[model samples]
Target: MHETRTIADLALEVRSKNAGPFWVTMELFMRDAVGYTIVADPAYLNASTVARLYGIDADTVQIFRLPALHVVKISFPRPVSQGSLRDRDIHAGQHHVPLALFPLPSP
Candidate 1:
């Protein structure tokens, strides 16, 4: 299901309301979007937000940049190293891409 609040609104609301850390709204946008996009910014999201939203450690969510519409290089900054994120970038149009986070590999 879709979220009621827009991404901009949600971000602003989060800072303003300090709405507990668990309530994060995952956002989807056109791939062509430029400049500090949510997808890029969230690469360095704080730990508290991850716990509040996905019930997972922010550190566990490996973020990476992808080339094709189907894959990416996942980098784990801790014990393990990197992996590939597959099929998740399958967006409808060619103009936009997706930034996805998945679990880090076990050491």
Candidate 2:
């Protein structure tokens, strides 16, 4: 039987942080090129999937693929302004959890 793998399992690091007062940035530093390709594939982690995961519009998600570095960077507008009364994560530090825990598509 094949073992299931998640983003966190294939990545060297998965992190999220505030890009600014209105934006959040998340990065996936894959362990190698293979992991990078898997994470960078639109079939696996496209704007649509990111939208569903973060409750944001697909058009608002910007994905940057750095195959040379085995990194994937994603940025999106925050639902609420940083430090606003409605905001929960001021730093957006824990926002990567959902993506990190997301299961990779079966090969």
Candidate 3:
């Protein structure tokens, strides 16, 4: 039989690096922690999706179960400026980039 896990479990796995690499921000981690503490509800999430939402690039997404208080570690290629990426404007008819989602173990 297949097992099912909650989003919180996945989050913990990501934080711990027991799963894989994912790009997550300090703010999103905080929100997830607080939301869990307050409501105990979990939402399915992927690093690339979160990055796109935050305007971070796909290459920077890493998978790991990071502590809620841990600082976000985002690095860019030498020619790519992090600040510029943050301030970069989306062109007309832009679409989301394709990124692979890490797999999670059954709960």
Candidate 4:
């Protein structure tokens, strides 16, 4: 039986924070090059996936692949401005939960 692995399982660290007042950034620090390749694959974690997960426009998502660092970085527009009345997470720290919990595609 194949055990389903999630992003959290492959990444050494998964974190999210406010890029600014209007955007949030998340980083996936993979444990190795193989893990990085998996997370960095567009088919696995692209703008479309991000949009669906966050309920935001796909066009607003930006994914950065850093092979050298074995990291996948993503940024997206904040639904509400930081510190605004409607903002629940001022630092955007909790925003990575969904992505972290997302299961990797089966091979």
Candidate 5:
């Protein structure tokens, strides 16, 4: 296994929100470019890895890296529509717990 650190160790804030009725997005904001670079690597933060964390198909996930802002954003299809009677998360905010638990490679 790779040497790793929690996102909490590098990100200034980690948040999740609803993109729409069908999607949830997670945002990881790092304090600076050095921290951002460490977590921004595709090897550690990508669709397939995130899909595994959320127990979803890789095709349903998308990742964006914003070097200028030192942030990483990820969007994925939700199994249920937002605010649907069957939905477990309404704001889509709490879904970021899984992302927080994912380990980033150590620099």
Candidate 6:
């Protein structure tokens, strides 16, 4: 069986912030090149995968891999407007906690 490691173990940082009133962005910073390659692959960080992870529509998910920076940036439409009465995250920074728990195949 393949060994697995949570993103918290593989990434140096996992965070989220508001892109705008309508969007929230999540970022993953890898500690090394191996971790970067694992998460940066299209098979892992694409729209479908992120959509499944965030429980959002696939069409709303977008991801960018910054190899030079060892970062994976993901963005999607926000369910509620930023700072709206129903919004739980005013800065959208708390939204990435679940992603930190995502299980990845360990290297």
What would the per-residue lDDT of candidate 6 be over residues 1-107, giving only the tens digit for each residue? 85577877879899999999999999999999989988888876688877887788999888888999999998999989988899988899889987888888544
Give, for candidate 5, the lowest lDDT window spanning 10 residues: 98-107
lDDT of each prediction vs. the true structure? 0.30, 0.96, 0.32, 0.95, 0.87, 0.87
Candidate 6 lDDT at 38 equals 89
Off by over 4 Å in 6: 1-4
Instruction: Give the Cα-based TM-score of candidate 3 against the true structure.
Output: 0.26
lDDT of 4 by residue, 1-107 (tens): 88888999999999999999999999999999999989998878999999999999999999999999999999999999999999999999999999999999887
Instruction: List model 2 lDDT by residue over 1-107, tens digit each.
Output: 88888999999999999999999999999999999988999888999999999999999999999999999999999999999999999999999999999998887
RMSD of each: 15.1, 1.2, 11.3, 1.1, 2.6, 2.1
Better of 3 and 4 by TM-score: 4
Clashes of each: 3, 0, 13, 0, 0, 0
Q: Highest TM-score among the candidates is held by which one?
A: 4
Better candidate by lDDT, 4 or 5: 4
lDDT accuracy of residue 48 in candidate 2: 98
lDDT of 3: 0.32
Query: How would you encode candidate 5's per-residue C-alpha lDDT over 32-75 as one tens digit per residue?
Result: 99878877888778888888888999998988999999999999
lDDT for 88 (candidate 1): 23
Q: What range of 10 consecutive residues in model 3 has the weakest lDDT sum?
A: 91-100
47 Cα displacement, candidate 6 (Å):
1.2
- lDDT by residue (2-89, candidate 3, tens digit) is 5543333323322321111221222123235543332222233445544654466656655334445532322222222323454242
lDDT of 6 at 18: 92
Clashing pairs in 4: none
Cα-based TM-score, every candidate: 0.28, 0.95, 0.26, 0.96, 0.90, 0.89
Prediction 6 global C-alpha lDDT? 0.87
